[model samples]
Target: MSSAPALADDCRFDDRAGLLAMSPEAFDNGPDEGWDALAERAGCQLEIAELFTAYRQQAKAAGHAGLAWHEATMRADAGQRDPAIALMRLTYKPHGADPEGWNHYVDATIAFLDDDLPALKRARARLAKLPMPLGNAREQGDDERPAGRPQLKIVDALIRCMYQPYALASESCPEP
Candidate 1:
């Protein structure tokens, strides 16, 4: 059996200190800065991946499944889909509650594939166990629960930005 990865020495900041030092602006900041810093400080992508893996493991062991899911999603969005999907599948059973969320997850995943219709269709069919959200509610509004989470909306926007295709400019380059 394969062992889980280890956290990088440099990326192993004390949670208490990090939280105490975190600014309001930092919360709104993109992960690129921090993730890049981690990669540079650790001196390798393997170490950075290990650090995130350890963090996810700790979150899962602590029963903070939502946090684990969030981390997994972030990693996936950053191009680590296999591990991310594995972690997500572990956190919540496929076809369990929150079908809408699962469908979105599958759709986002298929969007990342290299336009393989057979694979895409298979994934869509497998994810059919989950219901799609009505009228893109996942993107348009915040989830109105006691939790009041905005992460879902953020994920939707990220997926759209990441996977949606764009047209190329014409060679003539004439202004429309």
Candidate 2:
């Protein structure tokens, strides 16, 4: 399993513009160790769904719902289902920290995953009302942070991989 790339010597998180200025490739190629192995183990959609369901359940049982659910979404992204569905699930998490417009986003994701394109389209219409920065923002800290949301970029890369898996081999964003 390969690790996430180390920041280039020239890069610095402290500088908002510089951080945002860095090319998407810089962050897209982060570590995704063992994802291929995990995916291979779960060959079909049913296997992947079962695996993710168990993982989500366990995460909730152990009281790590927020992070665990996020991780499960990532796993779903790596599984046999449509990559777009996986990407949507991760990006459209509902009932978490900020549930404001997440319900529609989640509805769209489920509809997409279930192969109900019409439902997904309708749900997406509702999701259009949300604010610009898609997905839940990582909790901000007292210290300064980057201007761009790298995590959202991560989601973008995942969506790309769904349609072009081999081209972005190490670009998958597995849970840390």
Candidate 3:
């Protein structure tokens, strides 16, 4: 409260020397110690969206495929739908894992961004029909999706909540 930073104030980072000096070891963690709590300490800070996009790009080029995905979602959240859709389309894409489920998920996400509920519904239906993967290939456990692709669930919830912004509807819609 009294000292909370406004979310809309800016995406700020600074102390390049300090951050680089700290590197991977200096990340903040929540009290759970299992979550990466975002850094709140301030000595010198700066805010600019360009740094984020560029950081994602550099990380992706260095083979962080998932960070690139995060960038796409970031763009979409910023209401930059076209760029997000384009970036999503160009990804190495889901043609690898459960291609059917993943591809449909991508289509549905684009549809959601486009506000094409019909297309979203169609894609969600396709995903629902596919054999579910055991768990997200990356991580498992409590986040394990017992029924189907987490993406499918997200689309379904988006539809259930009438596709409101994920943040707006996530309480009713749950996952993002």
lDDT on C-alpha atoms for all candidate structures: 0.42, 0.41, 0.52
lDDT of 1 by residue, 41-130 (tens): 422434445544554443233554544454454555345656666666656545556645555444534444333444544554454444
Candidate 3 lDDT over residue span 31-130, tens digit each: 4121122222221111222333555443324544543454565556555678778767755454565554667877888887787889989988888887
lDDT value, residue 119 of candidate 2: 70
lDDT of 2 by residue, 13-62 (tens): 23434422433333222243212223333223233334334444432334
TM-score for each of the candidates: 0.37, 0.34, 0.62
Query: Which candidate should be chosen as best, given lDDT against the real structure?
Result: 3
Off by over 4 Å in 2: 1-63, 78-99, 131-176
lDDT of 2 at 152: 38
Looking at model 2, how many pairs of residues clash?
2
- The residue ranges of model 1 lying beyond 4 angstroms of the native Cα positions read 1-52, 59-62, 94-96, 107-176
After aligning candidate 2 to the native by TM-score, how far in Å is the CA of 111 from where it should be? 1.0
Candidate achieving higher lDDT, 1 or 2: 1
lDDT for model 1, please.
0.42
